[model samples]
Target: MENSINVSSEVGTLKRLLIHSPDSGLGKVVPSKAQDWLFEDIVHLDTMRRHEYDYYVKTLLYFLDTEKIKGKLNEIDGDESRNFYKPDHPDYFNSEKVIELQKLLADILEDNLTKMKLIAAICAIEHEWYTTHDELLSLSPNELAKTLISGTTPGNEMLFPPIPNFIFTRDIGITINNHLLLNKPAKLARTREALLSQYIFYNHPMFAEIRKNLIEIPDNETLFLLPEEEAESNQSTLEGGDVMMVAKNHLLIGISERTSIYAAKQVIKVLFEKKVLDKITLIKIPKKRDYMHIDTVFTQVKRNMWVILGTLAKPHSESEDEVLIRSGLLKSKKSEKVHLVQFRRGQENEPRVIESLEELLTEISVYDLNCSPLEVQFIYSGNNEFPFGAREQWTDSCNLLAIKEGVVIGYDRNDKTLEAFKEAGFEAVKVADLLQDFEAGRRSPETIQNTFILLPSAELSRARGGSHCMSMPIFRENFE
Candidate 1:
């Protein structure tokens, strides 16, 4: 059956989301090879995976050492075919007895490769049967849960590189107004991320039917599948972080460091062709790591409010209206204008000009957003302080995740941004504080609006992402 997906606005109540809690994949990263695997720093995975394993082991012990097992052992002892079995017989050495033991272990072990090894050991000792890897994966969810969260290796070699960047799930794919656009990350570090989303949407039972009506877009790698001449200079790539829905039918995508114009053009073509979007506005920002995605600099906090990097909110051009009129290139009813400019990069040999949105208007306004109904007000990061804005932007001050209209989640460390929100009629609160109040029945989420729920960021901040970058909402309740 096809599952219905309705995500029309960023602040809609999230009903379903996909998250990969940290797993054994962390062990695949090492200091010497971190960069190769896309990790900037090494995490203590052995402890983390061991904790998961230990929990699984407890579940195994509880399930295996049951009254049924005792009864079965007694039955084996009572049976007297040609040879009699004894209660004291070596249970580990007996094939029938060991089969139950192996099943118990396999059911709770979380790492697939390690589970396979357990299967191999059982077969080798029993000399009874050999199980294939596919057969192991086909086990029940009770069995697969133990194995899917971690990675496994044989001896000293790393079989699967840990997906550290998986925490920032927003970069893997984008959920358009109604369709899902799976992104092809520009770097190899994130290819598996794309594959994971693809697998879930295609194979996972929850999304099986949705595939029928939902339009599927390509990863940048799809370009390589085309002829060389067709693929040349077509290094298109899009990350979910760069794509956003500012209104019911209006969208804004950034052609920034992480997203390329080539990729944007391809995505825009698909959106228009499918009629999935009415007005799509593409913005071009300076290609810098700190501002890798547009969300890093701009995102809707509510229907009429937005939080923006101070640099972008401030007019770089002489006049915001003039820039829009000169650079704005609006299409007919179905299309909008984007500006593109040509410039030189660091070296004369490098071309560094941005292609305009109507193809490069450097302003954020009603015309720029292409949504006149939106009377957007700004909440500047660092409260418009130069040094503070620069610092907080690096730490993702502008990237906030809206849970409901006027209520959002962000990093607690960005105090200035929080103050800016408060100044603009938003109430400030911490996640921990909110949880305590909710548990006490003191308040409900529905009653909260324009509230900023700040998350602790000791380690999360190190990932260089904010709350918006950490989640990929698959479904949201329709508000209209």
Candidate 2:
């Protein structure tokens, strides 16, 4: 299958995306190493796979490649081995549309030279014994691919720490229109992920045609020469979660916990030079782990609508007295505020200062999308309730993936956020129920509109990401 790469807008009809399922590596996340691996808490691997991620795979397949999963649902579920969900197995539902990262890794490993180079690279970074390279080389492509990701050998011995965060594929790379911008992860735990992704995107046949368009952010030339404190501040680290290709001519880059200001500046300079887009918006959120990426605070539900955390969405009050108090409070706690700046191609010196996230999103709808002001809408996280708003936002209430315009998938545990969606005139349905309707021909993915599909997320939510973070959409029907 030819891999068509294009994603101009967040709410475009998703045609193809990259995803990684929960591997044995997740089960190996002991409490002591959980934080180091970037997981808030350890999760039950079986439950996360069978109950949580499996549903995501099925749903994506149903929407993007219906013939791959439409009638075989029961048969696929009945198998005790669950080979249907295993990328290495013969029965794996290998749909080109709903692409698997592990499967792509294995495909690249099939080449002898690529396998040797990758194994050597891994061993060098991991400080593995020289013999370890030969051992990994001896394994078959499928087994080697599994071991590389899970950090385990065929004998069930751990060779190294697993890349557990690989499940959040969106952090690896992002598709910007016809170009691919790869990530330089901020955390040491994600170094292996970046290396593995570099090899895949550069070496894989699927990305061969678009290799020239791969955008890699280079570090500052004098970064190593700076003082320790200055070097730390100047480090160029970026993740896909911080970048959003919101429209054909517009892009959003967030400076947060995982994406540095230096990196954002580099992106703006490189993209502007390449003429990838006309405008770039820099959203500076607090450098706190709770709001790791901009998508965690908000995401587009449709061309004219957005779901956001109320605290950052807008000012709390319009009354002069309350505004005065808020201004005083903000002066002392400036770090907590969200800052927005917009830069256009020719007018770089006169960048526009956006007041709030709501204002920026409204402008994207009204000006970029050409939607009427009256048609634009906002759904606050936790329905804008006090404690619920903060609590649900932490669980990624605002982080959602739109399968198509006005149709999204989020964690089922976010009840208040679901309520917010309902209040915004969207039908909230559980994934299991929706799958039945799709199977029975009662509803179709194409026919669905103004709906929110909920996924079972008891274990999945512990990983600290929503469907948006789990998906790396490479192809979407362009609104242009």
Candidate 3:
């Protein structure tokens, strides 16, 4: 099968994606190191997998590759070892459409040269394990792949810290119209992820044809000569969460906590030079952990609809006293402000400034999507209600993944958000129920429209990511 890559829009019919299931590494997250691994709290790995993420896999299979999962649901569920989900196992459902990151890693490691290089590279970073290089090389490709990701041997001996955040595969790389832009993670904990991703995209046979199109943001060479504080400000760091290929000719890059302005600048320059995109919008959001990435604050539900955090949605009218205070701007909080700037390919100097998030999204809908102003819609987090808005946003109510236009997957715990969806004339259904309906021929992925498929999120929410952050759509059916 050819590994064709093209993602023009977020809400396009998702045909292929990269996902990593919750592995033993997730179970290894200790309370003290939970935050270090980018998790809000340690989750019950079994519950997160069987109850939450397993449904995600099944849903994707049903939509993208029905033959792999349609009639075999019973046999898959009956397996106590869950070998079907394990990439290394013979019984694994290795669907090309619903690809697994670990499976790809294992595939690449099958070559002795690649395996040796990866093991050496990883051992070099994890200095303590440098002596075990020979031991790792002796292991099979599958074992080595698992050991590299989970940082444990077959006997469960810890060689290094597990990459618990690996479950969020969207951060590894992003596909933008036949091109793959690799990520440069901001956190030290995600260093291994970046390295592993680099190797996978560059060496994996599946991505061989598009290797030339793989864009890696170059670092600002002069930063080293500057003072520590100055260098920090100009550092080039970008994660996949900050980048979105919203339209065929337009891309959105967020300057947030995980993505740097310098990196965004690099992207604009490279992309324009290569003519990958004609317009690039740089959205600078508050550099707070609460909104780590722009996707965490908002995501497209359809060509004409979006779900955004209410606080950042629309600008409020100011009183005469407030207007006067704004002249001095002494009391205004910088952290709460959002700034948007759009740069066209030729007119880079005279970039257009957007006033608010709503205006920018509205423009995309109206201009790019060819939607009328009256047709556009905005659904606020927690139905825009106070306390609930902030509470639900914290749990990623805005971060939803659209399997198709108007059909999104979100957390079931966000009741207020579901109510908002219902108010907007969307049917809300649980994933478990949806799967059963699919099996019974009562409903199908194609038949579902204007719906919210809610996943069990008791443990998944603790990871601070929704279905959007968990998925990296490599291919989507063109909206046009």
Q: How would you encode candidate 2's per-residue C-alpha lDDT over 1-480 as one tens digit per residue?
A: 247898999999999999999999999999999999999999999999998899999999999999999988878777757646778878888888999999999999999999999999999999999899989999999999999999999899999999999999999999998999999999999999899999999999889989999999998899989999898668899998899999999999999998988999899998999999999999999888889999999999999999999888874444633554576634334556789999999888999999999999999999999899999999988898877887898888989999999999999887888887888899999888988899989999889999998999999999999999999999999886
* C-alpha lDDT (0 to 100) for residue 33 of candidate 3: 93
Between candidates 1 and 2, the lDDT winner: 2
RMSD of each: 14.3, 2.2, 2.5
Per-model TM-score on C-alpha atoms: 0.67, 0.96, 0.96
Give the per-residue lDDT of model 1 (tens digit) for 1-480: 024465777766655454444444665567897766655567665433232222211111212222223224334334433121111124422222112211223333545555455445433432433443455445553444323323342223233455577767787766776677878677776765565455455544455556764444554667768888876446777788888765556566777767778877777667767777665666777766667787788676765567877656543453544544566521222222233333221222333344433112232234333434445577888998857987888788888877667777777788888789888888887665565464455766557677887766655565677778866766666655
For residue 217, what is the lDDT in candidate 1? 50
lDDT score, candidate 2:
0.91
Worst 10 residues of 3 by lDDT: 315-324
Q: Write the per-residue lDDT of candidate 3 for residues 122-176, one digit (tens) a residue.
A: 9888885556998898888889889999998888988878898888888898899
Report the number of the highest-lDDT candidate.
Answer: 2
Candidate 3 deviant stretches above 4 angstroms: 317-332
